[model samples]
Target: MPAKKNTADKKISKTVKKDIPQLYSPLLKTYFSDLTSANMIYTKIVRSPITKGRIKSLTLEDIPEGYFLFTAADFGEENYVETLDIQTEILASSEIYYKGQPIALLAGPVFTDLLDLEKNIKMEFEKDPASKIKEKEYPYAQRFIRNGKAQKPEEFTKLFSKKNYDIKGTWTSVLNAPSCNEANGAFCTFDKNILTISTPTQWPKHLQENIKRIFNLKTEEVFIRKTISSGPHTNTIWQNTVIAVMASLVAIKTGKTAQLVLSREEHFEYLIKKSPISIKIRSAVKKDGIIEAVQVLIELDSGYHNPFAAEILDRLVIAANNIYSVRNIEIIAKAYESYTPPVSFNIECIDSQAFFAIENQMQKICNVTGFLPDELRMKNFERKFSLPFTFTNEKVREAFSAIEKMYDVNRKFISYRMESKNRKIDIKNLHNFPLRGIGVACGFNGIGYFGSNIFACNQKMEATLESDGTLEIHALQPSASTLEVWKNTAAQILEIDPKQIKLNSIFDINEDLSVPENVYANVSVMTYLLKKCCQDIQSKRFRKPLPITSTKGFTSAQKKVWNKEKFSGSPFFLSSFGAVVLELEINPYTYKIYIKNVKAVLNAGKIGIPKIAENSVKLSIQHALTELVVDENLHCDQISVSFVQSDNDPTQIDGLISRILPAAFTSALSQATGHEINTIPVKPQHFFKEMISNENSVYSK
Candidate 1:
């Protein structure tokens, strides 16, 4: 990496330089700009129109002279989009599994002529009714169950029959377009068997390996440069690689630079979306509000052909029970391949559904036992921490108390229950007063990768120190904010100013660099490695060698042993506790639910950077709000968020506001409307149908 030039006339004092960080570095500004245009060819991907079918024939007889067409047959070897567990096809060869699947690549000089060529090209397909795909399935033998060792069907029936209250509900979460709307593009050029590509991605090493395998090139023959990215919480890394590989293939074939810019519509159609999930939960609880047993069945649609479906299912299974303690529980998680695009894992999207299911069950217990939502949560709160994944009950109770005190939860919950009862007795009386309700939810978000494998929980970093007292560090793709944290950490260890450090600004890590789900855990791993390097640098400061380098790898102990074959063990590394209280009102006439206010308390271990942690909490809440209630039809009238920092202990909170906010919001909506809401992206139509059904039952009585 070239050092950024100092264009200022006069240099600042060292003391002053330590206080001010260059927020926008020169290298960062130009990372996303189109770098190559001279002698470059534009390319577009031709896709399958049908959802699932077989191609009879494709015609390109009227193609222009300068244009080029490349299909799956053009590649030297078959390419598979790989994961730790499974592999899916990179390009369609014979059968197309889903709509918008890549069929062929077309490249030429003029964009309009390429469009005309696509219009002229025609294909015939034979559509099989059975081939109209529904969903792909993971193996049943890979399921994990706790305290559900009944082998006979009769014993299973007896288990459900002995409970005081048997309740069942299904929760569904649909696709949520991420906030990042910036268009994606890539450019590639080859010279002397060295392929250089520029693109913005979060998974560089994965792409490099894929390119090498596809083109039959060596690792040194391919070079990838970093670019500015909005870092949309989606599968853009894989989608961008598809574009990058396409460009590289064109450039190699034509002996010229190749580039492709996808339109916004194309981005949605081609990229994987957040898979829609359906969760059916059945539980038995005592009249005194104790959870006796629980059984949950979760099904998610992995669109098209994707091998990452198991990762999503594994996370849901881990979070199925949330933070509550139950004696007998059985969780069945299944991923079905559908016609839509495969949904990638975001922190919020992966764990939200399971949290919703568990929280919804708690609300139902309140309905049966005449307890407020907060009261029920407090009753069932786990005071003692579990092994392998330990949580501080003191922190959870403190946060829960703060939310209750800030929002006056207990009094409002009682008042709303009374008002709802009065309105239910006489529907006409509710016209003048909107239905009001308050709900609270508490849970912990697990950090690190989903499973508890020892090998998957390790990270590595390298650091070098120069004779001039400057410290240089090499890390896997770390974000700018993370780099700042690492620099400050090293400065503290070395007893020097942060300006004495030189660090790489790349934002791409190895695609499989297993760490916590959140960014802070990855930073912690880097910090641990840096600490060891600093110790080496300090010991050899004046002894012999001027420039010293140290490389180290850090791995946490496997506190919980997991059996992959049986799919049972402790799957969490560490967990951060959080609670949310949602206060809202509902229009009785229009059936529109308006969120009046939201008070949340997050207890992530310790505070390193309060501002960044606070911003993450706010963003998580905002994203969750949009996903649950603030869509095109529903509206949130008011919202407020507050953070309560834990005691200055060494522990860090895994960012978990996203998982907490949605569950609380949905529970509060159910209380406000006096209707059990099981699905997310709540709409008025669901309530309207419920209202009609209720009225008919009343008329019959």
Candidate 2:
């Protein structure tokens, strides 16, 4: 073997720059300008009409000769849309799996020209009239298995039997309404090969990959830049990206940058929405209110293909027990694929169901054996932390305690019940006016991707000591947190002023770096790693402990450090725990619900950037509320189901108020009046209306 390279010989004295003025950086201005311009023009798209049919003939007539057309045929057969390691034809080639699938793309010099041309395109399809697609056949793990033998059907069946449990409770939620009336898109051309495609997106890398694949070029040839838009929390991922890709392709093909915008009708009609779910739980409890076993089955109307059906099911299975210690647990999660658009994950709905099951069961046990819900929960709460199987952090517990104290949960519970008994709050208020009810939910979400899968990051940070003593830091990504890490680590190593250090452009992935483009759940972790590595390098350069920058990778080891899978420890590099309490009033007559106030307590490690952290939490709550109550729909292929109405906002029906309480508050609701809220978007009046009419309840808890 050849001799190993010498570290001492490789070391070089690189001079750093001083006070590099970045305030007027061209890249920054251009980036912002490009984003702004892209948002001005609206882009619209027309999709194929057939589902599960072949494109026998597609004719473009009575349109401009210069118009550009793109289809699955544009990209080579080797290129395909990939997700979760599964590759499928991007544009339907021989057949379409669902309606509204993109088969052909058209673009013109003007937006109207594109729309006019779309009206003229003629197509013929041979539909599988006898086909009846079933949803339950598609298992979440189906894509992960390469061969038919990876997992025997019996294994899944056995696992189901072994882990099964019962759940008993009712959960209700109200979607925080959505604003779909105003929807549009725009694009601009920076250069031939480099175009800054901007739209609402949750997964930037995935969109970038799709663009690269569609263009049939290397990943370096195309770049995707993200801009702040409405959260992609709902179904913006597929809808926005697909439309953007089609528009970008048109611009590239026509040799004139194009902008394809969508109307609100088109946006809702073509996109996917959240699926409504109903879970029935039954449990066996010990005399001490400890759960002996749980049995639960969830019915999810995923609409079309159930893209997130499997993941949702997996989460439900894991969440059945909550933080309480149970001897045996069993869960059955199933999805029903319908003609509607595919439903995405609704976190609030799932949490509500799980909490309702666990909490209601606690209440029932309390009634039978004489105990309080809180008393039982605390009695069975896990005292020790475990890996993948269990989640109970010290900070989470402290956060909960703080919230309880701030909210006076015990006092409220007693006071509310006494008041209700003494003077029954007019039940008519449930229908006629905004009725108020308080609710609290406490839980922690795992930070990284679920399971034992390895999460990889290829990050590098370069620091140069300038002749003027100022340090310039360059990184692969624009990590605001990583800049702090570099500052802290470098300060200790070089004994220099943190303010003197300046951070430069991040490695542009579209230009230089290459790695899988997926959302990094814990971006802070990456920054932390970079900081530690840079600090080590600086220390070694100054003749301190050890050597210069060090590169390290981690994988999920089999050893259980905390009595759980090792992967669980990775997120502990940092953790965030919080609780939310919502107060709502329902109008029984109008079937409306009004949010009165919200109190939340979050413990973020060290609070690196208070503003950003607070904003993130607030945004997360907003997104969750929209998903839980918004009047949205999804189809089979996991696209949004459209409606004839222009306004899709849920707030249109009634009064809605939202307030954010500090992290010092912690508490759950003691009681809620009106119809028993068992499902999300708790429209108690709607339920009462249906019940009074002797109709099946439209809302399921």
Residue 533 CA displacement from its true place in model 1, Å: 5.1
Instruction: Report, for every candidate in turn, its global Cα lDDT versus the true structure.
Output: 0.65, 0.46
Question: CA RMSD for every model?
Answer: 8.8, 12.6
Tell me the TM-score of each prediction against the true structure: 0.85, 0.69
Model 1: how far residue 49 lies from native, Å: 1.6
Q: What is the lDDT of residue 125 in candidate 2?
A: 79
- Candidate 2, residues 1-701, lDDT tens digits: the string is 11111111111112223232212111222222234333233334557676666777776655555455566655546435555564545566766666776676665545677677777767777887524435457633321111111145453334333233333554332233455433535464535445556554545566666775666545444555444444333345444555666666555544455666555555555453454556666665655566555556666665555444555555555554556655444456666665444555443124444544444445445434544534666666774433235553344455556656666655655554444333243332233333344554444443333342222333333466665666666543344554565576566567779898776654345432332222232354444554555565665665643323355333335123222232233322222334555555444445454455555665434544445545555554554454443352211111111111121110000000111111001122224342234455433345445434532232221
Worst 10 residues of 1 by lDDT: 1-10
**Tens digit per residue, CA lDDT, model 1, 1-701:** 11111111121112222232212121334444367577877888888888777877666765666677776666535456553444556567768777778777778888777888887666777876643346244432234565544445465545666546787888887646454545676778775566777777555656677787777766556667646664444467566777778777788887777777776777655663566678888877777776666788888666664545566677787778776666566778877666666556564337767787788778777776787776666666673433222233456666767876777888887888778777678665656888787777767666445353323555567788878888888655466766777787778877888999997544332334333222323654556567778887778767868788887763444534554565655554445677888887877777776778777677655666777766666666666676675344334445555556655332333346666666677777777777887777777688778766765666677
Provide the clash count, candidate 1.
Answer: 9
